[model samples]
Target: MRLTIPLLAAALGLCAAPAFAADGKQLYLDNCAACHQPTGKGIDGAFPALAASKVVQGDPKEPIIRVLKGRGGMPAFSTELTDLEIAKVLTYARVTWGNKGKPVQPTQVTALRVGAKGPTVKPALAH
Candidate 1:
């Protein structure tokens, strides 16, 4: 019975992205876990860890650009993920595993998209 659900989803092409668009962990699982691991502890010497990394918790643009443009061995997700998805995934990483970073909004991701065309993203208000 449980198996049938997965099989049905697979057969109907209902097992990806859209179904989990707002879920950062799922998005990470689908797009990043292979290299970054489920716990955000990436394989040493291969992929960097997100658990307590300064980069992940630092300027959001650095990671945003990396996700969009890819760096070193990482693959670019700009073509596959929407701005909101990227923001969710990044926000998940930033807030998870004890790291202290600001939430990344979809507008931030949209702002950094290469050749992206749309309304300009306004700066966040000071708290």
Candidate 2:
């Protein structure tokens, strides 16, 4: 039996597709790890610790925005990373390092990327 071109193309497409979360992890290691650290424990007072971070534990929006636009001390990843890439990194942080928060969806990140005027305010952590 001979493989058709269309069938071959479809198979290649599936094989070449990017795993978003896995890609995001790589991005985090390369771009975010220096400060956030591999274990997600950031340098003291320079970068906030990601483990059980209030920013990551609650709403995914604010953190997603930070990843895209960056914060006071953090560099903006908007020009550095694609929207999908930002979503993946944020999702990885949300779930890693003993943090039990939900994942940040790519669609949610994409929406925020589109509508953000500046950094969106997140709710304060409860005592």
Candidate 3:
């Protein structure tokens, strides 16, 4: 979810960047709500729930990289989503559904985007 500001802007097709996390709700509805659900509880085993997910909280970098690179059944959204949009979506997911990970910053996401090579598969649980 957490993409860099540059990536978010690219996703929105916007060049002008905004300060602070933008509308996370809007970002979710636009991209993830369909699969993740409005409540963040994903379908049974199809798209794992974000609520209290260790993957979501354990290492925010992984999810951000996933969104950027995609894996398995997930399509690569790196081209479609801008960095900022990714950041907002990750921030929203992290805070919602009892997830306690610190909000992902655009910069962190950007770092992952640059460093990550292939799909980032996490363990069943974040340790």
Q: What is the lDDT of residue 12 in candidate 2?
A: 65
**Highest lDDT model number:** 1
Compare candidates 2 and 3 on TM-score and give the better one: 2
lDDT of 3 by residue, 74-103 (tens): 776666666666777787787777777666
**Number of clashes found in candidate 1:** 0
Work out the TM-score per prediction: 0.72, 0.73, 0.71
Badly placed stretches (over 4 Å) of model 1 are 1-22, 114-127
lDDT (Cα, tens digit) per residue for candidate 2, span 1-127: 8889999977764443335446668888999999989889999978889988998888888897787777888987766766666767777787678777665656687788777665443322221
lDDT per residue as tens, model 1, 10-79: 7554333333334677789899999999898999999999999999999998999888878889977777
C-alpha lDDT of candidate 1 relative to the true structure = 0.76
Those runs of model 2 whose alpha carbons end farther than 4 Å from true positions after fitting are 1-20, 118-127
lDDT score, candidate 3, position 35: 85
Evaluated against the true structure, the overall lDDT of model 2 is 0.73
Rank candidates by lDDT, best first.
1, 2, 3
Order of the predicted models by TM-score, top scorer first: 2, 1, 3
Position 74, candidate 3: lDDT:
72
